[model samples]
Target chain A: MTSHPDVEALAFFAEELLEPDEERTVAHHIETCALCAATLDELTAVSGVLADVPPVPPMPQDVADLLDRRIDEAVRERAGSDDTATETGGPVAPVVPFTRPKKRGFNGMNLPRLMMLAAAGAVVVGGGGAVLNAVMSTQQESAVGGSAAPLLQEEQAEEAVPDAAQPYKPEIVGSGTDYTSKDLADQAADVLDATVPESGYGAEEEAQDGSILIEECAVSLGERLGVRFTLVDDARFEGAPAWVLFAPMGDTTEVYVVDPAGCESPDGVLEQETFTTR
Target chain B: MDAVQELPDRELLTRHTQGDDQAFAVLVRRHRDRLWAVAVRMMGDREEASDALQDAFLSAFRSADRFRGESQVTTWLHRIVVNACHDRLRRRKARPSTPTEDDTLDVLSNDRLGRVGGGPDHASQTEARLDVHAALETLPLDQRMALTLVDMLGYRVEEAAQILDVATGTVKSRCARGRAKLLPSLAHLRNPHPPRDVTTGRGGANPS
Candidate 1:
């Protein structure tokens, strides 16, 4: 029987065979051919001996210490620059936007402005809740069973639209007491109770509004995660102003910034914090 | 700072982008040891390695905002260190060093292969270690790096290729060639054969 010189082929494929997917092919070929199998054995043995070699001694301790010091200094310099930017309320150096193709519709909208609006929404929702409650409480007593009931129902109907679409919700908070205080609280509850379907965020205008809602959602999420969100820096990304969202996690903190370029992936966002474990 | 310390790499980087020095320090401390090893091995001298390591780390820190986390932190740092080491080597080579034949031979002797044996054989183990060191020094820089990363340091070939910025095939070929060269040198330690003419061609003559 004339057997093929499979050993040379195996030698050629030894490295490829190291990958798990190629093992079956390698094993089948080796089983039918003794020469290739022996070659594999030799390669394996050689690799084993080489593995026994010790690593070069670690870089000297003093050198490592110096590297640590230099890194610390660089980090400190960056922190100092950030602090200065925060103090002056000046634009901070932009984090490099993700080097990916820009997403559609991201160009027309201003993300930082939207983020600020979202922040304002949060403050309005949280701080205005009690005032809204007082207004609704008084209305509940006065309008127990008359034409005021229809007005309250109509107001609730207006708020039933998703938060992104309900421009009237913020207007209610802004134009405080324009409606009877009781009606405003009922309207706020109506806004909170309405569900914002993911599908509603499709049109460019809607998407921009959706982005604001998403930012609000992120803020709420951060709160739930025990992270405090602080706006520490602002810079332009891909021509749009990007806001730095700083969240303190225990003794360590995290920074998340939207990409002005509107990169689609999570990687599109920049995380530029020098964190240490407390 | 303590709050920053408890955050994960992703969170830490976010803080770093916002200009948190403590967050950057955490990243440096996390990566320094392995980066140092890569630098030291590539440069083959402690002083040069230190310089290379510091440059790489500092540059990485300055550019932390640019990091997209497409690859693991270690892989990214390794690429930086390797690039720095290559630059240093190029500069070192631009200024030549002349050594006496006796010194050259002494260095070669130090490169001898060490035996792999155990028991109360401290003397033998020490001799074997010396041999391994000598063998490592004899390899070309590329092969030496491949061997160091793949065999000794336990990096997968793909990871090593990323760090070395080479195709996987190139890493594999270098690793194979490196082992082949080291094998003969190691075998010769046991048999004491006269040195054969070493050729530079690939697969041309693997002295058995």
Candidate 2:
């Protein structure tokens, strides 16, 4: 209070965090003190600069798409398993609590895998240095459905993936970084959009209003990734319904072939692949 | 459900918990950007921010029902993101980077050439900001988080207290101490007042 309001006092003064009398004392002293005044001005400017740091721009589009897909998968995985009772005419749980499930893989979205996929996602998504030295990603590199040897029969896996799934190599939009669940959904939507024209939906000119379809798919993809295939409309691809699927790898999102009459786990048809149906 | 996107975040959250699947995504979309800003600055690395963001959102989705309506969803989300970033930072021990090889001049040049005005003064401002950012990393984690929430992110001290789960006095003291350390780091950015000009022993203008 006496020995010329030190740096803390100057900062508290700048921040208005001092007692009223202390504030007055600092103000009066600063009025006569150039050094403290300059110091306060500097502190104020530092705060200004920190505030000026720009907001990271919404995880970019690709990342958002990826995030959506992941969330969808998690939602469906939970719903798919938890709702089995309802599916079998058993009593439904009265409450749907948003509690964190046991530390088990919520359809393969365990913490370690989520962390691993995020690292792989950042790299494949392309941005930021090899974050964490791709540390987590490399640990589970094979399980990610990225750079993994096919776990299923090569023929059936190839059959499931099909060359059609290869035609439209995803442009993985925006700066490659931060693949959120929504971002994954958007990536799936991209596949859906690209698949429409290929499914004989129409020509480029006819289906130009594909915006509605893409929008529908984007929203629907989020809720139905691992849940029951909600046969989004009667749209068929390669004589089968195109379904939104969450690959076991926990990151890939694709519109894959679904047989409604024989609804089955997608893991059977495809093992660790990101591809489109038909 | 067209209004789903337009509903208050609380309502959206309610709908989400009540089984409106798209509701959670809407909430995430609504708040993700600002939360991204928090995560990026706190995590101090782009990838770390991304990872933390993913965990935060997933946690938010799982924990939405736990929100007892005590605070704005934004505050709730910010806390989650901060906690996520803190976890990553702890795991990585990624120190706030020093000026190892990235010179201030290099940072200046990296700015859009035409954007930052050509002058030593503009360069100084750029360097000062970078320095402040680097300096921020040097603080202890608690001080860093407190300073970040109050100063950098513009959260109210009370709200920061809630987010950090600390007393307001604690936030105030942290800011005070953090600012005290920061001032010296930022002294060059302050008006360069000619080194006191008191070597004349005349005590400059103020003879006191």
**Highest TM-score, which number?**
2
Each candidate's B-chain TM-score, in sequence, is: 0.71, 0.77
- For B1-208, candidate 2 gives per-residue lDDT tens digits of 3777799999998987777778888888888778877887786656556656766786677667768898888888877777777654543343223242244335534552544443566655555455556667667677888988888878899999988767898898888788777655544444455233322321221101
Mind giving the per-residue lDDT tens digits that candidate 1 earns over B22-125?
Answer: 77678767767777767765665566577667657755665556667887777777877776676545434433352322343454344323323433265554
Q: Per-residue lDDT of A7-121 in model 1, one digit per residue for the tens?
A: 3344446666345655566767678876556555655554665566556665566766666655654444344443352353222212111121122123343333333333332
DockQ of 2: 0.19
- Model 2 chain B worst lDDT run, 10 consecutive residues: B199-208
Q: What proportion of the true contacts does each candidate reproduce?
A: 0.31, 0.42
DockQ for every model, please.
Answer: 0.14, 0.19
Error of 2 at A121 (Å): 44
TM-scores of the models, in the given order?
Answer: 0.45, 0.53
Q: What is the clash tally of candidate 1?
A: 35
Candidate 2 error regions (>4 Å): A19-28, A85-278, B94-126, B194-208
